[model samples]
Target: MTAHSRNTPQFYLTAPSPCPYLKGQFERKVFTHLVGDDAAQLNDLLTHGGFRRSQTIAYRPACETCRACVSVRVRVDAFEWTKAFRRNRALNADLVGLDRDATPNSEQYSLFRAYLDSRHSDGGMADMTVLDYATMVEDSHVRTRLVEYRRRGPDTAVNGRGAGPLYAVALVDHLSDGLSLVYSFYEPEHRDRGLGTHVILDHVQRARALGLPYLYLGYWVEGSAKMDYKRRFRPQEHLGPAGWELKDG
Candidate 1:
């Protein structure tokens, strides 16, 4: 066998479970643990092959009879700033995103709990405690960072850190090709600010500044209202049978 196949990670499959995004449908996943020295490189390969990283595990949909989940990545350099995107940016101009180590804190947990309660109360992670949140942020074996967004203060220019209450948080993984958005949450009360769109727009800027080509946005499922917003970011590449194909407006 070749070196590529020799180092190939072992994968396992999960039993069928109720689909979170679709009604009356079941979902299964093929997953593998991302660990050891080759974790980062392996992660990049699997991600390009349509896997999503969650803590130390990398998984992709392996439903028996369904193929609704599709992986997507933004073409940062080619992304156009639409009028709606500009509006979101303008609305969230007062916020500053501070990149920090993947260490969890009580304040972040408070915001996480509030967000889950208000938005995803019936979702899978609704019962996640503070410890679960910590594990989610710190269990990663690859390069990871937490971007905390807060309202800018007078000292922001001097310290380069946001002040006041946390407005949103994004757990991101730095890959060789681009930034992978693992998970993000925002203050539910601030929904009017369009924090979700702002987070993605900020990541596009970050990818451009870092000279990366794509911003991995995980899986986008058709017929899922929660995932419909991902389609708004134009000029993205969708992973398909023939490989990544550009989907422009």
Candidate 2:
């Protein structure tokens, strides 16, 4: 056995559990801790290698006999907005996104609670408390930013931050090569507006403007309706054994 150095991350596998994306299937994850001075740089490389960060740990699916979880990243500069995407963008013309330090507050928690109740009531994170929400935002040992979406209101000229109530929020990580969308949620009542897709489109444009090459959108599980939307982002790359391959379809 090779001796491990302090800089080497130790990997662990989660105990088999019921798969969240697939019915009647078990799932496991291979993960390692993200900490210390090199955590940010290590996270960037691991993320490109198909790992995803959840708080202080970086993980990816490692289930036996399953290849359903595919990592996806948009080609920022080449992404073309579809007619529907354009419409969604127009629909949200009055909305503005404000990036701030990852500090949890009551307002964000209220919106987060409503989002969980309406969109993911039966999911694992549905029962998360305000403290849990805070940990999700503030527990990171990496470069993270909280992007809050709100509608423009009176006195918009005074403060650059959007006014009115919060409609969506995304926890994003800044990597060396691109931006990683860790998690995002929106006002479930406005689901018809396609706020989720719109946020992604906006992020893609932001990444391109910043000279970044990709926008990570987490895992795309095959056969999961909740994850089907990810495939709509054309000119995306999917990570596989052979490496990241462009998916035209």
Residue 192, model 2: lDDT of: 81
Go through the candidates in order and give each one's C-alpha lDDT.
0.94, 0.91
lDDT score, candidate 2: 0.91
Please count the clashing residue pairs in each candidate, in the order shown: 0, 0
The superposed Cα distance between candidate 1 and the true structure at residue 178, in angstroms, equals 0.6
Go through the candidates in order and give the C-alpha RMSD of each one to the true structure.
Answer: 2.3, 1.5
For model 1, give the 10-residue run with minimal summed lDDT.
1-10
True-vs-predicted CA distance for residue 56, candidate 2, Å: 0.3
For model 2, residues 109-193, the per-residue Cα lDDT tens digits are 9988998898889999988999999999999889999999999877666786788889999899999989999988888899888
| TM-scores for every candidate against the unseen true structure | 0.96, 0.96
Q: Mark the 10 consecutive residues where model 2 has the least summed lDDT.
A: 152-161
For the record, the alpha-carbon RMSD of candidate 1 to the native fold, in angstroms, is 2.3
Query: For residue 190, what is the lDDT in candidate 1?
Result: 81
